[model samples]
Target: MSNQLDLFHVQRAYSLAQGPLSNDQLYQSVAEAAGLASDALNQRCEIGRAKAKRSPLKRKIRWYQQTLKAMGVLRKVEGRRGVWELAEPTDKGLHQAPGRVCLLAYSTRLGVAIWGDNNAVFSHLDEPIHLCVTSPPYPLRIQRRYGNVAEHEWVDFITQSLEPIVKQLAPGGSVVLNVSNDIFEVKKPSRSLYIERMVLALHDRLGLSLMDRWPWVNLSKPPGPTHWACVNRQQLCVGWEPVFWFTNDPLKVRSDNRRVLEPHTDRHRRLLEQGGDTRVTHYGDGAHRLRGNGFDTPTDGRIPKNVMIKGHRCSDSLRARAAAKRLGLPAHPAMFPTALAEFAIRFLTREGDLVVDLFSGVNKTGMAAERHGRRWIASEIILQYIKTQAELFSQFEGFWLNPALAVDSPDRTGS
Candidate 1:
């Protein structure tokens, strides 16, 4: 049996403010209006309440209504009993109750509470994942020191390891694998094993297709060097890493072609007022039409390119060290920044869709999922890391950590 805190919160909020509308009713309403019965109006309300338990429920409901209305899922009618309803008739009744179970188990909102051996995740996931962003262990000799397999074994291991996950990925979904070449000696650089080989293996072996290659450049320099280099400085290394963006089916991947431009500076404005060409200052060569509220504008004056700059660093936590020692798990060497994960979540997923990280390291992806309001499912092979992540999320979000919340405490007081 799955937990129902997420579902109960959504249902209770809907019940208190408006009449209890069945999932079917909500679905039908959405389908009629938008041709897509899947709307997150109620789902968002549930997540908002789940996150902000200290806040008043009325405030949470207001916030939910506003968010959904802005997203064009809730419509306001002019009638005696005009109220917020689904924008269209839903083809299928709202299955939020069952859906919430899946989310609560591994959702991004709840954070990295659900983690353990790989089997724990496969059992819990009910639907195919839409997108996956992860940087698994690289093929390096040093990796073996941490109990990870040797470098030569990576190809076979990665291939066999991801087969089950690929099976669970939706045909339309995509996976972005970020990896880099490992350095062994100061002067000797191993033949750069192109990640394309793995991409090809997945496609030929598992039917996953390579869609794109995203170059992740770490602008910041790493401090100091290994045994090979006494103190390497400004090493003309291949700083850019490869992120193989693969999809089960190429057609479903969506790219938002919007850009955010910097406003004209005062100097440029003054020049424009003087009847100067001002074209270079006001409308740059690559300028495009802006849309949506100014707040949600995309960065970079152009649609985000495949190559994303790695500008953020991993979180620093002494607590993680303690937890690692207690749990007897090797420390994670590299973790993607929450900001990077957030970018991927926003660009790849809709508001309420599930975002998964197959190889969760230190729960960065989970934190990103919570920040962006996306449901997440993450799996970590190590037990210690899982426990540490669960504790961190429970303390930070104030959500019930135990999955037994459904049967152990139906009162919902823990939330």
Candidate 2:
């Protein structure tokens, strides 16, 4: 239960190996030292019968690994299984005097892909794109200069935009579209049904299949619908949106669910150690549902629920906002959480894979793509948005990037 020596143990294991360890070797060694099965070491046992919860030890190891990796203490690589090795330290210049160093200046070789129009960008990209993750402007009561279509025209607009995009997908690639329903009509409290309509349109008209849907929740968000939510308290505040995953072939999409596994709670560890649920219970979604045998405490970690809880990084974005103001630019009003892009990227694409964003406002997708070692090309119509985003990226150097250059808009005259 104590995390007193997890780092020490992990570091010692790596020290003994003196080289990268495959997931099997590293996990088995750790488990043997701890007097547990290799798979059990990764198990998250439940703590109680009544409440459904699990342990965090297995998850803690991963968290520590990630933290150490982030701090340059270790490195993790992807392949048949994870490959991890102790990393040598190099000066990141963090301690250097202010304004003396900038990371982006050194990482510019990775190349930055920027375009002003989606159609033009797609036409320009002949290479296959492994994934397309974007949070396009949605139908709303007031038009944002960033270009949201009217409610009635939204589906057609999206269908037309995606026609070229889907063609660029590499075999088994995916598209994750982040969208929310519009509540413009006060009487239609349940929302304007635009989101559902769009999903149907994507399938019926565009030949895209709805693979999965994630409910993205923002806990500390602004209240919605002044009439029903704030004043009357007749409806709960709107706090979630849907991120729809689509692919041409639902049966075969480039997905590695293991990458997005979540940490289990304290209770799950207990159950995992026992190698069985506290009591026999069936998990749903198929006929082969059994609770005791291979069904408990999977070593791959627990699949995250369909609900995604992510908050906008307010502090980080606020700094960007101030910088935008100083530069005489407006911060994007409807930017999705960075994790939205990150989740889709890790879930669907591998390292060095290409990800394209058709409506990449402010380069949130660009930032996430860079973090995951994935190549990225993003298109945004607004020049100021691209300029401000490029300015922000110019300060950091965790990933390789070329300077973002502007391209003449192919449809510059359209709304």
Candidate 3:
């Protein structure tokens, strides 16, 4: 058989084996999947006059299996003779080879979920990323079940996490980071300046330029910081978080505001119909000027402001949480709204571009990218979270779970 056909048979063998399979079973599974006749599959190869002949197809399968193992795709079962299985996750990353990432799951033609540490996975990325968007764990006063660094160590932690990833970004790619604004100093009322430090660190370390600072106002957020805001009367309720946008090259940043435009409000529509203001208007002692026909022309939609007024209780997160509950799994602690991810994705990238999220909680970026016809790659350390994300993504049209990574059944862990 040709090398390409041999490779196809080998891949089929790997995919068909759900658990540890013996050599004979693997060969039979591959033969069945590829519709190969037993005679063709069992063709013998001559070695020496005194030795027994071996099947060439089986030898090729073994060779390809070793190659896949070198690429971190398969593993040999310990204490079991001639048995093999798909590689499992380890604390250091996937267990086979160094500098190779394992795919946890993937859609038919849209995206993939990488199973491992973000830093380890980022270092092995071979393709350029167009958009890198994520809401990493917040640097809180108290740590949550999902890992988060201390307030004082946040800048360093984030810098280390993003440096390698940014190095693989396309020339004009953008990185949108959502950071909490409620992180306060230890035993003090003053807030930490980690966001500002992060901006400067990325700029100095990764040569990225700050594009804009968008404030995401969660309208449905309840009052928090109870001690300072409600009891001490020292701080006001913080209902907004800062989202920083950075680019590899400021002059050529890949962005189009028109893609994320919102529908015109009633007042704005009326103003357009009325042919704008009749008289020239000036504010701040003529410093700001408004022309009479400025609003006369109609448009498809209005350009959105930097202040995004979105509710925290988005339907996507709600539905995902309910699904987790139904499956007897713990709900994700912090799931950013899919709308927010969609806004950034549409504004920053065109269809078919690659969007990446290293700290994916529920893989919202993947969902948003899939909805908009963009390719995506999401990496998360926690197995349960990635499994939950896979369940949600399976509902997408044309979704295809990677058979090689589906052997290990999911165990309920804190989300």
List runs of model 2 lying over 4 Å from the truth.
1-111, 186-190, 232-234, 278-298, 314-316, 396-415
Q: What is the lDDT of residue 393 in candidate 3?
A: 82
Q: Write the per-residue lDDT of candidate 3 for residues 255-355, one digit (tens) a residue.
A: 99999888999998898889866668889989878777677778989898888788887888987887667544568888889999999999999999999
TM-score of each: 0.56, 0.65, 0.74
Error of 3 at 297 (Å): 2.4
Which of candidates 2 and 3 is the stronger one according to lDDT? 3
Q: What is candidate 1's CA lDDT for residue 252?
A: 73
**Model 1 misplaced stretches (Cα beyond 4 Å):** 1-112, 144-146, 183-187, 223-235, 257-301, 315-331, 395-398, 403-415
Candidate order (TM-score)? 3, 2, 1
- Model 2, 83-156: lDDT tens per residue? 88877422221111111111221133333645346765566558888888998788877666565678888889
Give the lowest summed-lDDT range of ten residues in model 1. 93-102
**Number of backbone collisions per candidate:** 19, 22, 0
TM-score of 3: 0.74
The Cα local distance difference test for each model comes to 0.53, 0.66, 0.77
Best by lDDT: 3
